[model samples]
Target: MTVLASSAPVLEVSALTRAFGGLVAVNVIDLAVHSGEIVGLLGPNGSGKTTALNLISGVLRPDSGTIRFAGQAINGMPAHRIARLGLARTFQLVRVLKGMSCAENVKAGLVFHRPPLSRGEIDESVDRLLRHVGLSDRGGLPAAGLTYIDCKRLELARALALKPRLLLLDEWLAGLNPSELLIGIELIRSLKEEGLSILLVEHVMDAIRSLCDRCVVMNSGRRIAEGRPDEVLADPAVIEAYLGVSPGVSTDA
Candidate 1:
């Protein structure tokens, strides 16, 4: 878990910016995620966290900036191209293929990896990913039949099927009840323990505090703070801008 500052980051962004017509959604922001680390992207709604993820995952091209993943440049690349090159992501809203069974959704992701799995291999891998995401019993169900939280799990299972080098998770823990939230946190933590690099955008402070190795804060399309989770959460500006609390108040209280 000791990140070598001198080592190249698994994901690196420099002066990343994006705009929509008259509005600047992301300012010149710089970020990096090293191997085996989870970096939390924190901000209020509309603060450009999702915009940044879109840009990073190639869902939307940045107006300006550079994105390097696994030592390759990726700004302006198509989302499928990015996924093929070892990057995968989940959306802020879960995106399972509604017409497909849970296993089929994962199978769709499985076919993309090199050395394509045989039919049996694909089936076995799909089952493993389903079990990993706590959906082993539901693999035969249609995605449209899934509950909200189950949809989130199915989406995660599909993303994992890509075997990505870095995963961009946009609010993956949102909308869970307390017990489900704890399981969600632990699921992400287990992913980190497996040495997967992650950039997580989350509003759930508990998940961010428990799962992130470092945190990045943004406001009005610009990065405002970056540091350990506790350090950034304790920052006066971040508390006011994101947590909606006056300084000196504990968010956990």
Candidate 2:
């Protein structure tokens, strides 16, 4: 797994802004991810975390600002083109096709690489990913029949199929129970070991503190604090915005 340490920035966002009619979804946000790092993006509900991911993934165009991937300008590129550039993301809601099997759902991710690989190679890669996610035996199951956790895993498997240099995940653990959260956290940790850069938007404070090297806190579509997880979590403004209490405030006081 790869962890960031003052290395070259793999993904850069410069003054990114997005709006929906009268609403400013993402407001002039600037952020970056290095070659090997796990960076956490956190905020309360309706914060711009998801909007930022969509802009970065090209799922939605930015009203202003720029995005660069691997040092190349990619602001206006289509989502598929961005995927081809080694950037992939999983949605907060698993978006697998109900009619497809688990293996087929993941196979869709492999499509970006183009000109199909030899059947042997394809099978080996798919099987390995399935096994890695502990779903080898379930690969043939219809996606609609899989449990919610399995659907999340399938989403992850599909994202990994792109061989992404950076993975953007939106609340991957949302709706999961304790056991499922643990598995997701462990999987992410393992991916970091494999040198995959990750930008995760999560509401789970424990997961962020344990798994992230740094945290970026956003409020009302703008970044308010960023640093080591503990430091950011302790910021007064961050606590006020999300935790509903200012840092150092005591109920007795």
Candidate 3:
């Protein structure tokens, strides 16, 4: 069920700001992800895109402003608490338990967010999630044994095991080959079709253009543009901020 679809956004940030000593990493940014939508958080390196995701996921607390999730103010909540609250995420650099089997990794997610499950139910969930991320055959292998792309898939499965209402993906598609990228895009699309809300910080323009219903662009810790992926990516200001090209105008020269 797509709960809390119209009454409020699945995720909302208003005037969100965060700073580290002398530098401001996130500066009064505002954005929202509605239910059943995938919103691309796009920016170049060091554009505070990841930092913004960190704040939303409770890895870092905002210095000011507010974060609301499912109509509740979630400012300053701890990361684990946030995850248990039906928001889950994967990191830019995939985090996995190298010592654990892929199935164990997924089981960790289930038990973390859902501890009352019977052993049979946990096993069923782990198998299903691994299959969902195309790792059904590899579930018995060590997480360290998987290739980089496969590890990414494993991380996604673990996050899905949380059954999050809103999922934050921080550059989860950064290291895939062309074929793998296509598969990754389709996986994410299938999740959205299943009624998941996502905020994706992705560098792959093809994925962004294909998957995102809306895009929010950031430059130097502030939002520079927001709109349809194609339109926002084409905006002169966004182009300038992302590509360092001057917004040129032709005149009698």
Best by lDDT: 1
User: Model-by-model lDDT, in order?
Assistant: 0.91, 0.88, 0.90
TM-score of 2: 0.95
Error of 2 at 24 (Å): 1.0
Backbone clash count, each prediction separately: 0, 9, 0
Candidate ordering by TM-score (highest first): 2, 3, 1
* lDDT tens digits, residue span 69-183, model 3: 9988998999888888889999998899999999999988896665568889998888899999998788889998999999999999999999988999999989889999999
**lDDT rank, highest first?**
1, 3, 2
Off by over 4 Å in 1: 1-6, 243-253
Give the clash count for model 3.
0
At residue 205, candidate 1 shows an lDDT of 87
lDDT of 3 at 214: 94
